[model samples]
Target: MVLEKLSKLIAEHKDVDPAGITLETTLESLGLDSLEVVEIIMEFEEETGVAIEVNEKLKTVGDVVKLIGECE
Candidate 1:
């Protein structure tokens, strides 16, 4: 569920196909800029009502999935 939501948000902001995005996908591969990433993070926080610290170690979609899971 989280992946679907996150992918949809990313796809909305980026030009890539959302169907191609997976947990293993890297944000850089999608050509997303820092501002886009920050927007997505804000959307996640809004939807989940959880404040997620933007971590430098978060590089993959799977990392975000894990973070959401931890917050819940």
Candidate 2:
């Protein structure tokens, strides 16, 4: 459920196809810079009402999923 919502958010923000994103997809590969990533994270937090700590460890979609799981 988290992955689905996250993928949609990312796709909408980047104007990309959500179907192309997966757990293995890296943020860098999607052409997302650090500022864009932080904006996405902030938006996600607002939508989900979950606080996510931004860290250097976040590299892939899966990493974010894990972080969300831990936050929840």
Number of the top-ranking candidate, with TM-score as the measure: 2
> How well does candidate 1 match the true structure in TM-score terms?
0.85
Q: What is the lDDT of candidate 1?
A: 0.83
The true-versus-predicted C-alpha distance at residue 71 of model 2, in Å, is 0.3
Model 1 C-alpha lDDT per residue in residues 12-32, reported as the tens digit of each score: 888667798999998888887
Candidate 1 local Cα displacement, residue 8, angstroms: 0.2
lDDT (Cα, tens digit) per residue for candidate 2, span 1-72: 889888998998899998899999999998888888888888999998999998888899899888888898
Clashes of 2: 0
Q: Candidate 2: misplaced stretches above 4 Å?
A: none
Give the lDDT of residue 31 in candidate 1. Answer: 85
C-alpha lDDT score of every prediction, in listed order: 0.83, 0.89
For residue 31, model 2's alpha carbon misses the true position, in angstroms, by: 0.5
